[model samples]
Target: MKKKYKERSARFRFWRNIAMFLPGVIVAFLIGFVGSDHPIEFQKLFDRDMLYIGSIILYLIIFGIASTYLFSSRQSYQMMEATEDEDEAYRYESQTRRIYDLATIFKGVMIVPYLLVIFFSCQKLIYEEKLTGILGKYTIPLTFLGLLLLTFGLEHQFRKTFKQIYGKAIPRNSSGAEVRELIMSMMDEAEKQICYEENFDIVFKLSNYVLPISLMAIFLVGITFQTDILLALVVVSLIYVYILVSQYKITKRYYKE
Candidate 1:
């Protein structure tokens, strides 16, 4: 049990460490999409390159610390669930609650940057006559809001389920262990079926690689060939559909497995 917990905990920490910095990458990408002309003075104070690099670094630092605490709490919880040790369970619960509070403090780190993007988009549309930017601006906020609500709803459901199964009491009738085992069993099945590498074939690989390259090629072609806007859009749409179909096939195979 100890050996298993150590292995699992180590893997969890390593992956969670990687995940901790992912918000920085997403923030950078979103900011790239929200590119706008800055005032000369503002640009002089902090150029576009500096802005992106600084924001990415700040996000990484904040999110990395928060994720470390959250992951630690999670690891401790997982350990508590596996063993029947009362002292260990108490220690884990105490540590979890303390660090969980710390993690929540930095929860807005990702959201704030995204909100800034929407704000900038709106500013551009209103003052700069950027009608085309309206779609991306509104879409980002609406989509982000929907995803936030969905995440909260799913988390609430998981918490409710956990409380119902395990309750507040520690080591109650060994239910924690039983629940852990059940979770592990489900994970094993999922890793075999959904995560199976065989589901991805040559076509999938080629499509994944070629999709971006094709899009870039099409952009170049559109510029050089000077194709009609509608025709270029049609070609892009076709490529998008092909990529979407490829993803659907992978998903279909997962379900079949």
Candidate 2:
């Protein structure tokens, strides 16, 4: 029975992954095929003047939704804290988890608008052939700074909630080693195995597929836009470094084992 259930689950997951992946593949194919003959007027569709405004609006919307989730999680946590009943606490705990999971999705979603802002800002600079003024000069740097702040704020809230739930504080100034130690200390062997498996999946997918595809896309964009080869090389270099680092970590772990 267990084996049958596992097989069924695996089959379902395979189909689900295919379903999620096929649309992107189809869309890319259609775009490349059609665009070769009938090119898109992206400039007309996405005016430089309005790109920044549109990105800002999108960012605000994402921020609002993320905040709503986080706020709901906090409220659930507070309810759990206030309650003495075991049943009530468990209910609130589950509610908090659901809300936090939604909040976590936004952590990835937030990157889209941030990337759009950077892309549009770079496009503006490239076309103009110079920084138009103070805004142009500082736009990329400011967007980066904003992204950094938003990431830090979200992570801080997440850590605070984690501490509240676990009754253990992870120090703000903890080094990477220290943070890993603290996190590992909180996990059982089974939980640690699950975490390791999930991380390995991420590393495997990134190294095997994401990096190569990203490198190809970067070069294609560079060729299409007539952007500097140096810019593409820099991105390629970063991707290579990530792959190397991941390989080193994996090797070190297996070698020790």
lDDT of 2 by residue, 3-62 (tens): 333446888989987886675577566656656544445366666858866886787689
Most TM-score-accurate candidate = 2
lDDT of each: 0.55, 0.75
Off by over 4 Å in 1: 1-68, 108-111, 131-257
Kindly report which residue stretches of model 2 are placed more than 4 angstroms away from their true locations once superposed.
Answer: 1-45, 82-88, 108-160
Against the true structure, what is each candidate's TM-score?
0.33, 0.61
Question: Over the full model, what C-alpha lDDT does candidate 2 score relative to the true structure?
Answer: 0.75
Top lDDT hit: 2
Residue pairs with colliding backbones in model 1 are none
